[model samples]
Target: MKRRTAREKALQALFQIDISSTEPSAAIEHVLEGERSDDYLSKLVNGVIEHLDEIDQLIKAHLEKWSLERLATVDRNLLRIAVFELKYEHDEVPEKVVLDEAIEIAKLYGDDQSSKFINGVLSKVKQHLF
Candidate 1:
């Protein structure tokens, strides 16, 4: 099987966290097992969770009319993963690359407009932060 991207793995872990009220570390451990577990994915999931509050704050700051609570769980987590990569994990991935991957993931797992929503939110974040 082709190796999944870190963003993809992070999305899954965040989805798990959203659905279950589990701790982020526990969720990361659960998701990072079997064939899915890998260094990149583990790092991304951990990194995002490590700075979740900061990432959420950045997301909320740029969200305009939408509250983070109002966003679809998948989209909210997608933005978290993207923002985490953009701000803190810059050494591992480029900003545009992370944003593009987030959009694609949102399209696949999020709502019909998830890609657009993620793009808009991440674009504002990028402008404000970078």
Candidate 2:
């Protein structure tokens, strides 16, 4: 699968896990709809799950007034996936690409303000990480 498609699937799976407390494999399967799972997709979901506390901490720190739980499901999971990539996959994916991809994904799946909100928060995260 294309990385973008994998990312979208990962976002959906993570969103499910976050909102419904679904099992990761089940969530991933539900999102895949019988399509073969991609390695990147698994890595994303599992990585996010494994590092959830740290990822949420990073998000919580950068959030201006909003808390992590208050974030929309799509917005929250998008940030998690992007933050996972930014933290662990930076050697493979540029921070700019990660940020841009997160913004684009947020635009597609998030509410009207989601893109800007994600961008702002992620930019802060990027600065902090680098």
What global local distance difference test value does model 2 have?
Answer: 0.95
Q: Which lDDT value does model 1 have at 79? A: 90
Residue 111 error, candidate 1, Å? 1.2
Per-model TM-score versus the true fold: 0.87, 0.98
Candidate 1 least-lDDT 10 residues:
1-10
Model 2 misplaced stretches (Cα beyond 4 Å): none
Candidate 1 off by > 4 Å: 1-4
Provide the RMSD of all predictions against the true structure, rounded to 1 decimal: 2.1, 0.6
Query: Per-residue lDDT tens digits of candidate 1, residues 26-119?
Result: 7767766755456767667778778889999999999878899998888888898889888987776788888888888888899899999899
**What's the true lDDT of residue 46 in model 1?**
75
Residues 1-130, candidate 2, lDDT per residue (tens digit)? 9999999999999989988899999999999998997999999999999999999999999999999989998999999999999999999999999999999999899999999999999999999999
Error of 1 at 106 (Å): 0.9
Instruction: Report, for every candidate in turn, its global Cα lDDT versus the true structure.
Output: 0.81, 0.95
Instruction: Estimate candidate 1's alpha-carbon lDDT, on a 0 to 1 scale.
Output: 0.81
